[model samples]
Target chain A: MVFENKNSHWIDPYTHKFKESFKDINLLDKKKEYWRFASPSIWYDKFTLKKFQETRSSQSIKFDVTNYNFLRFNDGILDTETLRNFINKNKNVEICSFESIFLKKDHWSSLKFCQAQLNAEKSYERPLALFNGFNAKDGVFIKFKKGVKKDLHIIYEGNNKKNCCIRNLFDFEENSEIKVYEHFYGNSKYNVVSELFVADNSKFEHYKIINQDISETVIYHFFGNCKKNSKVKTVNFSFTDTPVRNEINLYLEGTNCDATVASMGFGKKESSICDNTVFISHQEESCKSRQIIKNALKSGAKAIFQGKIFVASKAQKTDGYQMSNGLILTDDCEFLVKPELEIYADDVVCSHGSISGTLNDDHLFYLRSRGIPLKEAQKKLIQAFFSEILDEVSDDNIVYYIQNQISEILTL
Target chain B: MFEIKDLHVNISEVEKKIINGINLKINPGEVHAIMGPNGSGKSTLSYTLSGKEGYEIEKGDIELDGESILDDEPDERAAKGIFLAFQYPIEIPGVGNLSFIRTALNSQRKFNGKDELNPAEFLKILREKADYLNVDMEMLKRPLNVGFSGGEKKRNEILQMALLEPRFCILDETDSGLDVDAMKQVSKGVNSLRSEDRSFLIITHYQRLLDYIKPDFVHIMAKGKIIKTGGPELALEVEDQGYTHLLN
Candidate 1:
């Protein structure tokens, strides 16, 4: 749904509706129904009907839930009597997290939907939309209870000899905040797409870091709604040979809403490129949105950044800013940055900017004459060029850790 | 301590000799100035002695203290106490001046099997030398000549020579672009570094610097060759009549 944000400083009007209506919103976000990052349902089924079926190749795994007619946890955690009560109390929720290690193909194929629970509502997200005509192939389902905040750390490792296609879905109840970290790394190469939904007053912060070796990945993401004062933040860092295209749309359906997306990409060698496209819509007045992407290109690599902001006619007083920059290290490298703004509201404050260029040549010459070799001289100049943004990263330990990783990455 | 016999430097694939040197000698406790007009190869002669590669040494045997150094690399020559205070001092950004000089000094020390000075010890000795030449303390904090002005850049060259304490420091036209005040300071720094065990090849086109760092002998260079040699009076003659008299 397009954001009807006006007067972006005001709290989201949708946040109030969810708290007031209080109906479990499984579709706060529309695109998420199409490109969910994961579907939790497959995980739930593993412990239920698929207990005998191993999700993976080896079955030396200790935890097998297939022997039980119903599977569940005790008191929201793994307690012995609580698990016994859950198994005896008519297993309602299917859980599949760490249990994936026991099964081949994942915790998914193990569980099958039993007709006995015909009255059961559908899970929150379904990632495998086209698998065997059973869209539940990859998905996550959460029966959100009011005021229950759950934290999840998810890592998507593309550990396949061949390419892989994955879809993910997630859900939240009213007044709940779900934070998910999606880290993507491949033993070789793969592509991943995800969809996300946010209910009223529910906050979702999805942090993604993708490293696809020297290949590429295509990413599609959408943020559904913020009923009053709900916020969402998305951060991405990509340094792979793969050219990745990320499309993010922030729909502010409520007042006093805020959304922020920041990303950094590194392009090197003859790799084609990394391009990011951001679409931010202010559907309500007083809704604020901000997006910034920085790309550093080296060798003959290329990078592109395209962002667009849309302010609805009804959405007045909206504030939005989009900035992008590309730093080229070699003459052969290239970059293109375009910031797009379509504001139907006249009173809104909106801004867009982009900058790209090669490293300063005179600076390199100066260092070399001082007896510093050419390559070492460049490393110093590059460090200086990126220092400004490096300081902005601000996490002292993380910054130092990343700097060491960057040195290792660029040693070639 | 220095000798160049039939030294010729050819650049590019072509056999055009930049330094068609016949011969010259620099003894200990002596400061010899090679004065020449533009393109007379004064800088080339000093560079060849310092051993910057790519300028192919076609035929020549340069000896320092009776040891042939023409077969050595720039670092080897530097180890043998040959320093070239460049006409254009290079700026090494990010590398602080104090550290750069110490690295160069310690590299020579490593080759010589001498003890290397720690940062604390090196700074102490460096500050004293800098104080003797009237160079500001701020200079040592900056990147090597990165943003230095013309005069400051030239003075930095001598600062390096003083800290390294080379035995044969060749000032490659170090006085070319300095102001009158800067010229005096450059000469003062050079004069402080001159000693009995060390020698100096003061390459210049004018005699203005000789007034401060008096040379033991003056040689007039023309077309890559030393066409004339005499005492300090020879500098006065060139200063009075220019290179026209020497050319004739």
Candidate 2:
């Protein structure tokens, strides 16, 4: 059931109908391979559906994005007034509600694509996406015209015990480029699903930072599709003590396309679980995909990384690489890494690697011998371990922000 | 400046004594070289003195400037003006060489109640020392000793020693993996840091390094004990007659 008491104005009748109609689907089965490592049902069983009214604090938050467009989401609900202002200010960009696409016959294909993604068997394999499909109050749909270049900053903030779902769709036309910064903060259950479609010769840089309260549960799923010669880079930076599961799937459907998925996480508290799962599919010739994930777990925290690369039989000359490294900081903590490569193309160059261990004693001795304190040395090494992956992000401002956040995570 | 009396150390994993009843002392401005054969516990002595874990000190007292330092942590010992240059310098990826040295230097300064240097001030001193050692400033931008050659790593160790400026230095086979040219370069860097207020304990198996930086005293160690001690001529004696001949 969805939030029924609070004034969820954006919650349409279709969402309610979808929940009731799809009650028989067993998407959260514990036996499913996708959910095998992290059994969501354990937490799902303890949760009860209810309407939680979020109090608007007197302290308003402001982001320094004077040169960029900003969108705000309050507990899975969009601010229509601000959205209208954004659309009015930007004449070349098209931003609307998800339902608006269904009203126009000329955009029928876009709507069909959304429907197929929402109902596809593979998408349903992830229970959180299905949960979002039947509960999202409203979704934002953004499209860029040919040769359009812009920076969009999206903020998600909320609190209390509300169970909320959020959906976002981004469509980039040919030759267009966009850089997006999505920041999430709060203590609440969230089911967030985002779909990105990159057309030929288009480029997109998507940065997602998750810094939620330790008592919250977050499940985020991202699907990206790249066309001919298009490049897409998605980086996820997460530091949470609660249960946070991130699933990223990228499809290289067009020739000469390249997709890079890089993520870094730190689990810092007892029983804090952070799981990152990524799947990349190369379906065309000469397509390239790279995945690098790093995690540092301390205390009794646990971290898991599952990465899979799939090269189709016809996708010759595909270059796929995957690596996952985990730094276990304490004896009480646990880190598990699983890297898989499924290649059907004979000429493809595919490789995968996974390594997990504690800090090197010799390295530690070297640092301490030079007079660095134990704690300071550990922090430096841990930060350096993540520097390689952080360097992949081209934007210096975003990288700086991430570095500061990482420092905070360690201190906390 | 540095003294070890009746030092007895044993490995924790096994019941065998690695450092069996050794006594040594070094005054200020003196460079003492210890020549020992393989399996003579030379490394064990260095590790025990540097406060590495797992080596049980059965009976010993290590003193720096008349203060016992056997119970101090590695960082504490470093703060008290003791430095060890590892035989095999470790590679720490992702940590820039300049940053590591600055951190180490500032950490000591902080412990000694001195103000830390700003980036500009630190860089100025680093450039001076690095240039004096003929070390490329570009190499400082890379990770600490990562991808460095054998000689480069040894030079980095000396660079750190020069920056930290410890009162007492322990060199653990710093010349084992270097050619003649590289050895001379490393020795030159070490000699540049020599002063009346500093003392050094150079541990090596060969006498070649002595040609560049002459030692005031030389000792022969065998079976975890200081079997013989003499002036610089002892190093020549060992060089002319192998360790086996001297032991016999």
Candidate 3:
């Protein structure tokens, strides 16, 4: 039995595929190639299929989002009142739940297109993403109309829930531009999956802030499909004290597409583990992709980065680059990096580099010789190490928030 | 006001002695130059005075104002007004040149129990000093010496020295990578900082720089020791001939 319900809506067939795929996944497989640096047993033991009761906590939203369209989710459940208010205010954009979008019939093609993209090749092979799909409930669907420019804020706040799962789908139409800010807060074992579809000549910018409690765990998966002449940029700033994993997969399926995925993470406690796994595929000719990952680790913390760029046989003139840098502050901490470039095309430009070391002694001495104390000089260099990624962020408020978070983690 | 007595320094890793029994003294308002060939331990002496690690002082005492400062850290020594313009200025990416200098200034001020200057006040003073040294205001906005030309990097070191206004300054091979024009600009900057209460220890391999800065005393160093000490004429003699005659 592929699915328990046969007479359900279109979502049943889409989710049934994932349910079948989940049966073949073994989360406890220690010898898994992708999970070599980071053991899967840690998150596998913490996985829970039992859903938690939803709570009503509107006051938990801490960030100032008064200038943008905001959506708040408490314990994996959306606030219907806030969604309705946003839907009423924004007429050009179509925002609704997956179930409601299926009934619209006008958006059925878009849904099918996204599902086909996900089903193509090995895109949906990730076990955690499959688990999220298997247990997926109704998720929000946002479609930006042609040439629409707007900013949207999504807040995921948990009320001490033991386990929760969330899925969000974004469809960017041709010539449209949108910036989405996703903030994850509170205490919970969260498994989230976000799927994005960028049409021709469209632009999509994604910014994520993951600041969960020290006792909880977070596993996030991002899948982006970029079409002809589209541009997609995603920047993730993670300052979590517990085990957190971010897996990003982007496919350049059309010519002249450009995609950039960058992340900066901080881990300080013994239990802190931050992992970033990225795979970018250039299937079409003349496409470009960049992956930049950096992390600062202290105490007994550990961080891992596994990034790969694949250029297909037909992907001539393809440009792909990957860089992973780690700064280890203490003797006990560890940073593991694996950067790979697999190109089947002869006329492609592809490169990757990985470096992990402590703060530079010469730089420290130079600063200290100018009268800056040892501790302060260290902090300044660490801050400067992460500033390259911070300079890419445009929003002042988000930058300020991230700076404060970095300072707090450093002080700890 | 600055002195090194019976200073014996060994490379910490291999314990190979580099400075074998060196003694030097410089009173206030005097500029002293140490001219040496390659591998003569000139830079090591400067680094030792500035409290760089990896140099073991087997038998020595560095004194400032009649107080021993062998136990102080680099920053503590800086607060006591000891500065070393590195032979190769370290390149720190993502740290603005202006901000780094300002931080250094404020840190020294705070350590001396004086008030720190805000950005506006610091920028005003930095602009005035930077202009006098022929430093482009645009360069200060970039990361410190990251992609700067050799001349630009040397000039930046002088800019930092001017901003800190240290009483005891040590220039280690400051003329190694500078062109004629840049050398003059840097010499002018250093000359402007010379005052009645300040002293300098200029370490170089040539006498061309000494022609501009005009050191009061010249010492010829070879084989980890000073072989000859004389007035300014000693530098002219070394330049006219070489260190081989002095060593003989």
Best by TM-score: 3
Question: lDDT winner among the candidates?
Answer: 3
Candidate 2 per-residue lDDT over residues A1-412, each given as its tens digit: 2345433334344456456645765646667766777786633533563321122112222335666688877776777776887898876688886545445546523542444244333533665665676666666788888999988888776655566677788888999999888877775567787888889999999888776342466788788778899998988887766677888888888999989888888877765777888888888999998898898888888887888888889999999989888888889987777788888899988888888888888888889988998988888889898998888888787777777777765665
Q: How many Å off is the CA of A357 in candidate 2?
A: 1.4
Q: Please, what are the lDDT tens digits per residue for candidate 1 over residues A19-58?
A: 3333333323434532232222322232232221221222
Writing each residue's lDDT as its tens digit, candidate 1 over B1-248 gives 88888887787556677778659988887999889889888877876777665578878789987889877766667777888888887665445676667767776777688998898988898889888877788977887687899988987788778877788878888888789999988888888777898999898888888999999999999988889999999999999999987888
RMSD of 3: 3.3
Ranking by lDDT: 3, 2, 1
Two-chain complex of model 2, DockQ on C-alpha atoms against the true structure: 0.82
TM-score of each: 0.53, 0.91, 0.94
Question: Looking at model 3 chain A, which ten-residue stretch has the lowest summed lDDT?
Answer: A52-61
**iRMSD of all candidate structures:** 5.0, 0.7, 0.6
- The regions of model 2 sitting more than 4 angstroms off are A1-22, A42-67, A81-85, A88-91, A99-112, A115-120, A212-215
Q: Could you give candidate 3's per-residue lDDT for residues A1-412 as a string of tens digits?
A: 2234435655666577777877887777767767887775556455552321121122222568887799988777788977998998887798876445546545634544345237333733577777777675546788899898888999877766546677778888999989999888776677888888889999998998886342467788888888999999999987776778888888888999999999998887777788998889899999999888999998888898988898899999999999989998889998888888888899998889988899998889899999999988898899899988888777888888787777665565
The most accurate candidate by DockQ is: 2
- lDDT by residue for model 3 over B40-156, one digit each (tens)? 999889889999889889998999999999999999999899999988998898787888888899999999999999999999999999989999999999998989998898889
